[model samples]
Target: MESLPHQYSVSVNAEKENELETTAPHLPTLLVAPPSQFDGPGDKWSPEELLLAAVANCYVLSFRTVAGIAKLDWLHIECTTDGVLNKVERNMLFTDIVTKVTLIVAEESLRPKAEKLLKKAEQVCLVSNSLLSTKHLEIEVVVGG
Candidate 1:
């Protein structure tokens, strides 16, 4: 929101037989490694997991903004994203990404509005929109305390 073209910077350091150290300005460094699927230790965050996390995080944030602008009252939202990676032609790439969203509202009447906003959030999520994978959204609205 500060400017039209925003920039982000991050640095990653790694040595042979060691986990990667990822850092950004003013943020704590993160240790990441390849996932177990790639024969890694499987105890650290991997690039694939990070990509899915980004998609889920962006969807939640986008929903917060859209719901606020629409003046919709809500209790909480849970977003879960799954990415499918497969061999494409000669390379491995994510072929599909599915985000499942659960929205809690104070009243049943808000269900329709919550569903609408959830879909809108998915449509506007920057991370998912930038991906070349097929994206799917699943919405569930519940009336709760």
Candidate 2:
């Protein structure tokens, strides 16, 4: 890490009856719109989906760093995140978020260590840590050739 505090910037542009264009420095622009639940076209990325994606992405990256430091050999890892939005009082917010992680290793002996590392990753994920919603993780370690 470069420093204790890092900054990020993104810009979003939209016009009446037009799709939203989102861009960040040195990154490709993304098309965003409201999710189907809000009566949007449901054909483009939504802020809600992006939020969940950030959680999943951060978890995977955290796991990679944790596994690398531990010198644990692994083949592949997959993470799927689901978020539940609900109305609380007069506000709307995510009530729960769950991430299902699958990790592949070469030997059965790695299962326990893999499980431990997965949990550790969740503990260290900054995105999930920042969220107020309840978070849950389901982990599966598989021995693969």
Candidate 3:
């Protein structure tokens, strides 16, 4: 297996009168709701954004960890994640999430190593692992040297 099995969990608390002010143990209190386009508060973080953030964040961290293990060094790595939400049947669901990973290396010889690490990162990201098959994920890796 590429990764070992692991378990993680978090607890959230919200008062009856204030659902927006939800807080989790060991985490900051955040206002949760739908996107502003759906009449939700514009100033708060929406669930969709949170989901995509998790994927993007996980990919970057995974890449770093893999690169460290592989002894591959790069100047920088940038990942842009986008989620496509569409109406399916009677519910709105995310049909696809696309992540574009760009890697910059000081030497041309590191390009192949960077690409390999980036692809491994996309495959090993925990957030992407948790997603169902219905949610399609596409990852693109671009290496610059």
Candidate 4:
């Protein structure tokens, strides 16, 4: 038996001078651009940042579902991602992405299970799975914090 494939799409409208508005049905419009270091607006979301964000967001959301199914309860989940870009030959591209996930749980005994769920989440994150760059995961599980 085979599973059905799913497709997603978004539209980007150019809004003059390195700024664009990205939109999809049922989602809020996003202002996007290159980073200020690349002569784009500082206040808008950069393509690099958005790429990292996609990775981080995928992991956390995946974790939520995995943790729930695994009976791992947490007080909070915070994920931060950093992307490293370098000039490779002549073009600049992301070389690596590091995602740090901090989970706050009420009981110390749940740490091991939470850690496992984090690993599973990374394995299942669609965005990270689709990226060609290297991804590093840092997991921090805190008890009652």
Candidate 4: C-alpha RMSD to true structure equals 2.3
Top model number, lDDT = 2
* Per-residue lDDT of model 3, residues 27-50, tens digit only: 777877657888866677888898
- Give the distance in Å from residue 124's predicted Cα in candidate 1 to where it truly belongs: 1.2
TM-score of each: 0.98, 0.98, 0.81, 0.92
Q: TM-score winner between 1 and 4, please give it.
A: 1
Encode model 2's per-residue lDDT on 1-145: one tens digit a residue: 7986999999999999877999999999999999999999999999999999999999999999999999999999999999999999999999999999999999999999999999999999999999999999999998995
Per-residue lDDT over 84-104 for candidate 1, one digit per residue giving the tens place of the 0 to 100 score: 999999999999999999999
Q: For candidate 3, give the lDDT.
A: 0.76
The TM-score between candidate 1 and the true structure equals: 0.98
CA lDDT scores, all candidates in order: 0.95, 0.97, 0.76, 0.89
Angstrom error at residue 49, model 1: 0.0
lDDT score, residue 137, model 2?
100
Residue 86 lDDT in candidate 4: 91
Off by over 4 Å in 3: 1-6, 14-19, 133-145
Report residue 107 deviation for candidate 2 (angstroms): 0.4
